[model samples]
Target: MSFTNNIFLLMEKSLKKYGNNVHYSVLKEEVLNWINLKDGGIYIDCTCGPGGHSKYLLSSGKEIFIIGLDKDEKMLEIAKENLKGLKNFKLIKGGFENIKEILEKEKIDKVDGFLFDLGFSTPQIKDGQRGFSFREDGPLDMRYDITSNLTAYHILNKWSRRDLVFIFKNYGEIKNCERIVDKIIERRKKKKFETTEELANFICENFKERKKIHPATRFFLALRIATNDELNCLKKGLENSIPFLKKGGRILVISFNSLEDRIVKNFFRKTECIRILTKKPILPTKEEIEVNPLSRSAKLRVGEKNGK
Candidate 1:
C-alpha cells in the first residue's frame, strides 16, 4: 500500500478502536426528516465536518448522492477516510462560500437539498495544534483553510485597536471591552500575542465575569470569526446556494451562535423564493443536550425553495 493508504488505514483502525467516542452529527433525525431525501436525489453538505451529516444522508437508503465541501483539509481527509467505499459521493476541499463555482465546475446543475451545519467539530477543538481551543494552549493560528493568510495571531497582534473593539463588540457581543482592548494594546507592544493561552489569559485577567462560560469564550469566538470571515462566508454561501437548489428542494442550516442563527432566520424570511418551513427555529432536545452539552446552543432552521 502507498503511504497515503497506510495513513488512512491507521486512521480507520483507530476509529474502529474508538468508534464509541466519535462525535456524531447534531440533530440527525430532524435534519433527515425535514430535508426529506428523494430517491436518486443529489445533496450538498455545505460543512461536512468529518462526514457525519454526509454519512447520515448516504445511509438513508434513498440511493442519493452527496457532494461534501469543507475548507479544512484535515477534516476533509478524515471525511474521505470515514466515507471510504461509499458510492456516489465526492468530498471537496473548499469553503461553502464558493458553492456556486464548485457546483458549476462539477456540472451539477441542481441538487435536491443543501445542509449547512455551522459548528466546529470535536476534533477541531480537541486538537490544540489547530489553535481553536481556549482550554488548550497552542499557537494563535485559527484559519479554517490553513493556506489562508489571516490567523488569530495576526488579528490579535497586528489589527488596530478600533478593529479589535469592533469585532469584540459586534461579533462577540461583549459591549464593555475597553479595558480588555486597552490591555491587549499595551501587552502586544512589548511582546506580541503568539498563542491561544496567552490571549485567553490576557482577556481573562482584564475582563472578569460571573457566568458559566469562561471570560475568554466570547473573545476567542470573535477572534475566530474575524480570522475566518465566518459571518460573511455564511451569507455568501446561503445567497449563492439558492439559485442551484431544485424547486421544492430545501435548505437546512444548523447554527451554533446567535449571529449565525439570526442570519439564517432573516435569510429564510426575506427570500421570496424560499418558503420558511419552521416559523421558529428548532432546538436540540433535552436528551440531546444531556448526551452532548456542546449541542445545547445549536438551532436548526429549514426552508424550502418555492416555485416562484
Candidate 2:
C-alpha cells in the first residue's frame, strides 16, 4: 500500500476504535425522508465532512451519484477513505459557496438535491490542536481551512476592543459582551492571548456568572464564526445553488446555530424560484440525541426549486 493509503488505513482504524469523532449526521431519517430520492439522480453533499450523509445516501438503494465538497482538505481525505469503493461519487476540495463554479467544472448543469450540514465535526472539536473547544488546551487556531489568513488567535490577540465587542455581541449573542471585551482588552495589554486555555480561563475567571453554558462558549463561537466568515459564505452558497437545482430538486440545510438557521430560513422564504418545504425546521429526535449528544442542537430546514 502507498503512504497515503497507509494514512487512510490508520484513520479507518482510529475511527473504528474511537468511534468516528468527526461528526454524527443528525436527523438522518428526516433528511432521507425529506430529500425523497427516486431512481438515479445527482445529489450534492455540500459539506460532506467525513462522508457520513453521503454514505447514508449512497447506501439507500437508489442509483444516485454524489458530488461532495468541503473546505477542509484533511476532512476531505477522511471522507475519501470513509467513502472508498463508492463508484458513483466525486469529492472536491472547495467550499459550498463555490457551488456554481464547482458544477461548471464538473460539466454538470443541474442536480437533484443538495445537503448542507453546517456544524463543526466532532473530530474538529476533539482535536485540541484545532483549538475549537475550551475543555481542551491548544493553540487558538480555529480556521476550518488552515490556509485561511484569519484565525481565532488573530481575532483574540490583534483585534481592537471595539471590534472584539462587536464580534461578541453580534456573532456570539452574549449578553455581557462589553464586560468580556473589557476583560480581554485588559489582559491583552500585558501579554497577548495565545492559547485556547488562556483565553477561556480569562473569560471564566473574570465573568463570574451562573449560567447553563460555559462563559467562554459564546466567545469561542464568535471567534470561530469570524475566523471562518461562515455566515457570508452560507448566504452566497445558498443563493448560488438555486440556479443549479433541477426542477423539483430539494435543498436541505442542517444548521446547529440559530443564526445559520435563520439565514437558511430567510433565503428560502425570499427566493422566487424556490418554495419552502418545511414551515418549521426539523429537530433531532430524543433517541438521536441520546446516541449523539452533539446532534441535540441541530435544526434541519428544506427547500425545493419550482419548475418555471
| Top TM-score prediction, candidate number | 1
> RMSD, each candidate, Å?
7.1, 6.7
Q: After superposition, how far is residue 199 of candidate 2 from its true place, in Å?
A: 1.1
TM-score of each: 0.92, 0.92
Runs with alpha carbons beyond 4 Å of true place in candidate 1: 1-21
Colliding residue pairs in candidate 1: none
lDDT of 1 at 225: 95
Residue 158, model 1: lDDT of 92
Q: Each candidate's lDDT (Cα)?
A: 0.87, 0.85
Tens-place lDDT per residue, model 2, 1-308, is: 54333434554555567774556778888999999786779999999888889999998888999999998888889899988887799999898988999999999998999999996886787688999988769999998998889989888888998898888888888767787788778888899998999988898788864456667777888899999999999999999998889999999999988889889989998899888889998998887866665676799999989984
Query: How many clashes show up per model?
Result: 0, 2
lDDT of 1 at 90: 91
- In candidate 1, what are the lDDT values of residues 199-292, reduced to their tens digit? 8888777898655567788898998999999999999999999999999999999999999999999988889999999988889999886555
Error of 1 at 273 (Å): 0.7
